[model samples]
Target: MDTDRLPGCYRHPDRDTGIRCARCERPICPECMISASVGFQCPECVRDGSGTGHAPAANVPRTVAGGVVPADPHLVTKILVGINAAVFLLGLVAPAVVVRLELLGRYVEYFGGPVEGVSTGQYYRLLSSVFLHVEWWHIGGNMLALWVIGGPLEAALGRVRYLAVYVLSGLGGSALVYLLTAPNTPTLGASGAIFGLLGATVVLVRRLRYEMRPVITMVVLMLVLTFVPFGGSLSVSWQAHIGGLVTGLLVGLGMVGPAAGRTRALVQWGTCAAAFLLAAAVVLVRTAELT
Candidate 1:
């Protein structure tokens, strides 16, 4: 062996290293090195000897939607709940924050205050409104639904895809509200995102070949409740619910549907992008009319 010269790492050819993998004797860099009881080993060697009692050909565990299975499957759901809770607390402390963040097309908040809303270029309200809640019952119901529906969805879809479904669903709801609802009406809640999770749940359940009765009943019940007028006051935005549901269904199809191999990720993200673009187009048309 050459004493002065060192070979490049097998994984990272650009780097020079003197250390060899304990199991395979292949030169490795610090990045590829995994500490073992005897000495450093390459990533391949470590993975092969992971002690899973399976052959090297065994597949790595992955979520249903192809995401790497995380240690804490519900971590994203918990974080989302925390964020909603914190935002709710902040809204309680400063009532004005709610007014600012809530979804409004275009309206004067006060007698002489400047107009505020998506029409006035406050586009962030589309997403921000999803987290703003004024009533305790409202936040409580949303948070509970989030925990129940979001946990399983998060576990199946993994964090990034789950979060994407959530945010896109919320935006889809906001866009519909902005387009159809009266400009002066104030709308806010996580219901749209929750509904999206519901839609995704339906798709996931179907994909997994689970029993269909429960999901069907849940969907029908939610739709009926959403559409039924309460005391002749249509305070709830059915438009948002419909929008989120449709978007979630489409994205979920892309997620767990038949697309395969290298194109799977492309299809999944493409569906998300398409949903976002459709929502943006709606916003643009609505903005033109409102302005």
Candidate 2:
């Protein structure tokens, strides 16, 4: 080999790069070129060689690969927070307009509400209720919990799986509410799904055998928030919390099961589809009874 023309292989001196790394402009042999975002990275760079860890830049929105310590790759936290904020804003504005316009549509019922009575065709509430909140504090608390857990969970579980857990958790909570609540009572909030995130976290920690401090602390705080009465009457829904937890348990078990290696990739997608179908059936049946 010519000594002056960089003795090492174009990709790696030890190895030869018939190809080059798309990112760092280094020669990479076929063996070293591992697939990356743009193209491929060298073995050294790919194998802890590159110092640029995937952390989101401050104030800049970007996605990282997996849940690392510095910044979570899963952007589910940001998206969920944005959604809650948007819905809360709408809740505030729509209430005013709904009052003035006398639109029955202004009221968002939870869990489809009463199977029969004057109230019928409000079936959409089963799903829409997840986005609705009775007050600012309600949304704020739930969103905060979501921010704490969702990112880490999403980072640990990929984005698709994270979303699967979220949607299924919400559905599970709603189903429990429907079976348990009096038909006349109305309930709503992301608490159900957020609870599922917490449950999922607990299970993840146990599976991964990481320090239980952070997750345990969060769980304790949540439990306190659920039961303790504050400012007189507490607007807490423990049922939804329990339901979310149950959903998370099922999701976590499926994710960590022996089949995880072979089937985890497609698990979330299937779960999401089944959950949607179930929600639809509930709505249709309730609507029919109401009508």
Candidates in order have lDDT scores of: 0.83, 0.60
Candidate 1: worst 10 consecutive residues by lDDT?
A: 30-39
lDDT of 1 by residue, 22-123 (tens): 678998754455545444556676577653355655534445576766778899999999999999999989888888899999976554585589998999
Query: Which residue runs of candidate 1 sit more than 4 Å off their true CA positions?
Result: 1-59, 231-234
Identify the candidate with maximal lDDT: 1
Give residue 189's error in model 2 in angstroms.
Answer: 1.4
Alpha-carbon deviation at 34 in model 2, angstroms: 13
Residue 93 C-alpha lDDT in model 1? 95
lDDT of candidate 2 over 145-220, digit per residue (tens): 7887887677656666678788788877776666555556567788889988888878866754445687888777
